[model samples]
Target: MGELVSTPLPTQFGDFLIKTFSSGNEDIPHVALVHPEVDFSKPVLVRIHSECLTGDVFGSRKCDCGDQLHLALNQCGAEKGVLIYLRQEGRGIGLTNKLKAYQLQEQGMDTIEANVALGFDADMRTFVPAVAILQSLGVDKIKLLTNNPIKLEALKEAGFLTVERVPLIGEEFDSNRNYLNTKREKMGHQI
Candidate 1:
């Protein structure tokens, strides 16, 4: 593990303490946005959101990333929890490949098909960094906010006890209905 840095981050959601786990090579490190006063004894609310440039920042409805990010932020802010923002762009395939996958999707392929067509898995993210962040914060149990069962299993496999799995069901739009369906049917996401 590289050096972890800490900083103050006051967002619209609330004042938070941001912790970054340096990867040594990436400019944007993995981050944990924690509410100022959290109760570690209880099942803390947690969201491990992968970096999504188009949806999270620009409000693109192509995927549910933007909505889910904001939802997690609000929940964390109000509930005094943590949000682990991973630096895994486009499910770890990087942005360029994500865009190419989008191009394939435009040609009538589903999201998973698009990724496969572009020579990538549907999801390439791992939860080791998230586990490290949680452990660094002394959080062993959490009520995870996610629709992905893989995330839940990964956390459990990483030795974190999940007290609950909070479903984050984002509204599906025409732009992402197929994508969302693909996640539900093929990828086993709860949606």
Candidate 2:
């Protein structure tokens, strides 16, 4: 059995709360739930989102992170699932570096290239904590909502059965076109 670490986070959304669990590593914080009640065994709908402050908080048009998060919240609230907000900003590079990457993007670098230029891997995030969090909550299966195939593969490999892939489809505009395209072409995301 994996060790479980958790804490409550208050929010304005309906019954909103955050529960975090350690995935045998201090750096990675696995999670379960952002709104409503959390139930691990209920075949939840999970959204494994990487951190994005500009997009998620300010509704920045540079990426679909915020929109996707909003969609997930609505879906999870209605369907009773979990939204695991991983703190892996910029795919694990953190907010400061993500901003730097954004600047590089302004100079014509794609998201992946900008991360590489900043001395970071293209995608440094790991799914171990997510798996650990689900297991700790007794969730052995889920209906994951995402466009990233890798997330499904990782969760499955880590022993969480992805019974469904609920696509977080939405419109992308000029400001985020390149970012979305890069995610599709380079990252193999199903955007």
Candidate 3:
């Protein structure tokens, strides 16, 4: 686990204490956006969002990452929750591999198929870092906001008590409908 660096960030969602966690390096660090009004009396609301540069920064229509990110941020801000953003781009495949998978996707393969074709698993991302961050924050339990059961199960397996599972459902567009559908039907995402 990495050490947390305290940084203040005020965004449209609300005021947040941004903690950047690094493993003895100044490179890309994982971050946690903590809402100011987080109350320990109640279970902390949390979202673990993996990095998606194409969708998150550039607003690519190929995935629902940007929409989910905005939804997570808005909801977490409103409820005084914590959003842990992990730097696991393209579900843990690098950007170049993701683009190559995109080419395979264009040729009629689904998202998972494209990834498997490129010699990777369907989803390489994990919730271990998120769990570590929560533990570092002294959060014993949380109301997790996610559509992926993997996250919920992972939290339990990691020994964090999940008080609630808040659904994060984003709108589906033509560009990402197949991607979303593949996640739901094949990968067991709740959509």
TM-score of each: 0.96, 0.86, 0.96
lDDT of 1 by residue, 114-158 (tens): 888888887888888888888989898899999999999999998
Residues 1-191, model 3: lDDT tens digits: 65558878999888899999873345888999999778867799999999999988999988999988999999888889999989889999979999999999999999999999999998898778888888988788889999889889999999988988999887789999999899999989987
Candidate 2 lDDT, tens digit per residue, 9-106?
Answer: 55444455566665446676555665456565667888888778888999999889999988887787777777887777778888999999999988
lDDT of 2 at 173: 98
| Residue 7 alpha-carbon offset, candidate 1, angstroms | 1.8
Candidate 3 Cα outliers beyond 4 Å, as residue runs: 23-25
lDDT of each: 0.89, 0.79, 0.89
Give the Cα error of residue 171 in candidate 2, in Å: 3.1
Q: Quick one: RMSD of model 3?
A: 1.3
Note each model's CA RMSD in angstroms. Answer: 1.1, 2.8, 1.3
Scored by Cα lDDT, where does model 2 land? 0.79
